[model samples]
Target: MSKHVAYTQFIDFEEDVKIRARDQARVVALREKKGWLFRLMLGLVLIGPGVLVMIADNDAGGVITYAQTGAAYGIGFFIPALLLSGFIAYVVQEMTVRLGAVTHRGHAEMIWGRYGAFWGWFSLVDLVLANILTLITEFIGVTLGLGVFGVPHAVSAAAAIAVDVVVLLVLRYYAWERVSLWIALGNLVFIPLALMAHPHWSTVVAAFSTWRIQGGFTPAFLFIVLANFGTTIAPWMLFFQQSAVVDKGLTVHDIHHGRMDTAIGTVAMVAVAVALVILTGSLVHGMPGASNLDIQQILRVLGQRLGPIGEDLFALGLVEAGMIAAIALTASTSWAMGEAFQWPKSINMPARRAWRFYLPGLLSAVIAAAVVLIPHAPLGFLNLTVQVVASIFMPAAMLFLLLLLNDATIMGEYKNRKWQNIAAFSIVGLLVALNGVYGLSVVMPHLF
Candidate 1:
């Protein structure tokens, strides 16, 4: 068995090296070409990890959170909040692109390599726990969304897991990423759905000037704020993007393209997010118990206000959100595990040789999907709670990220500048304070 495994690794390694050589040769050739068309072609080639991560960031949990936000509070406050979150997402994720390109190392490997075993183990455990929890929410979104069309929960969960596994294991890295991106485009379904709602453009534009939560600083208000932050900027995103950049074989030369990719994705993410909020805010915001309704109830409201077709479109969007996120999350889990254990980590490697690398992610997805199949699960609360949990864990993740970005020995000239530090520090500071306030709201119940 040992000899067989070693032989498979050797074979996979040789094949992957050839694959990378061919891909990089094209990249070098493209770099030398000087024309608008060539530049556009180069941008398309170099744009994968950044855009995928950003799109996957708007996963099932994100869809639910944004929808809930609009249902509960209207579009007044969160429209601006989502915009701020997008800025924060770009600021934080852009750093990862540079870190990965400069160091050619995954976030897990760097944390372990530079910070000692204790910190490494801490980060790995945190990421795995958070990722599994997030995957459960993704599965919940999948099953619940499909439930709209009378699809059985069991079938949806099983089918989602099966598709997710096939996509992860069947393709090498490049094909896997391209397929995921195509699916991610389904996230924009919410835009047309929003337009179908015929929202008051004047009210939507006025949200920026009237930036205030509908219900003062209540516990519900606090939860939505933190949940929004959590969904927008999760811990898993950091590990996912950095590992993706490493696996994609992006280097310093591609950093400019990486930045462009991230920028494009950020715009798309914010656009979809705002669109969902608009759809729900227009249709469900004034309904009784809007703040507390589960996604099913929210869908019912949308159907009554918009119609069955609108409801179906929203459900389709939800399923796509789950599918895309599951793909990205499963890959991230596999990559982090492989990096930490010093296993062969690239998706370019044959799955037969890297089964150990693939198993953890697929296993997590199966478990999450199974949990969604269980009867009488409190999935709605669980979805928001997972996002809150991510928010709570985010400060620690950001701390590691900031430390890595500022390390002169590792990052050298790529080390974060003063403005980057200020922006990052502010994000971390806001997360910490929000977490503290949420804890107070739970404990004291009357602080606000």
Candidate 2:
């Protein structure tokens, strides 16, 4: 292999080399073992980037969006729609795994290397802005979720920052991945919380066949559809998972495992989303202005209907959603910046040695947390707006991703197959069409 390709495909840091070497050795040993349980153990070790990206995709903004969808429309449409979105997310993210594993470079780095600086910087700026907006909503989740336990916003925000910094700085890449996965397990809290709502099983099952939007083709319905799309398959996910695969030292050999990891995460992501919608739909649907109700109001209604325990579990889930996402977003920001600017970047590097790599992510999180503390800020709108912004930006991001994946010079044998390209373009087409429809709706309000 050429030096350029080799460098693109592997970490250069001594610390990263040592750690990943140890990990690779372990994988080899596991592969030599002869049993299904050993295969499962091997799979566990290989399952970080995909799972983290998907679960983190269900961030605080996502929690709010799902809750709002449930409250406004019930489980009639979005439950099945959530499953579809999960498939979309998996298809997109699986490509990233292949790209990262084949090239050993983050998405930003690949864009910069293959494309030009103009496009590269454009993609970078777009990602940074979207990540900042999305990160702020995450802090909104952290503060609001903890507010249920009587924790003040400032305190919750500060504590969240502390936890994020420690996790990013103190842990090496392997440790960070393990810890993040453990925290991500908290996302399942929404499942039991949904159960607390005691939704009718028949109604939930019937939604698959019904698949009807509650309010028909209204502007609000369109907005929610876009918001759900944004939350499910945002641009940051493409960057984060690919960078994570690189940082975690996945190679073309690990593509199968990486794909499996992404698939599992996709299922978890959709299941939790369905649960959130069900929880709110069973309790809050049909309330006055349900579509317009914010997170706090939604929580209050949940409290009223399911009692305080339901409220607390939902709140705890929100906090977990925010905290885990903050970790991923912070790391995503830091990794993208490092890749774009050629700064030294790797989670394996200790803070004392790689503060430049870590500072941007930390700073972004602090700024987002500060914004969440603004008294009477329209956080609910801000949260939904962030997801919409992501939806608007996704097509551009997807375009770049498609171009990279189709380039045989880079992807070689792993170049996107014909079916994959079709699926990707279809997703982009749907996003563009919806955006245009939304624009038409705004311009000529009487048409619908």
RMSD each, Å: 3.5, 2.5
What lDDT score belongs to each candidate, Candidate 1 first?
0.90, 0.91
After TM-score superposition, the amount by which residue 441's alpha carbon in candidate 1 deviates from its true location, in angstroms, is 1.8
The TM-score values for the models, in the order shown, are 0.95, 0.96
- lDDT of each residue in 216-322, candidate 1, tens digit only: 88988898899999999998899999999988888998999999999999999999999999999999988888888878898888888888998999999999999
Where does model 1 exceed 4 Å of error? 1-19
Model 2, position 360, has a per-residue lDDT of 93
Model 1 residue 27 CA deviation (Å) reads 1.6
lDDT of 2 at 10: 41
**How many residue-pair clashes does candidate 1 contain?**
0
lDDT of 2 at 54: 94
Cα error of candidate 2 at position 285, Å: 0.4
Ten-residue stretch with the least lDDT total in model 2: 3-12
Please give the clash total of every predicted structure, in order.
0, 0
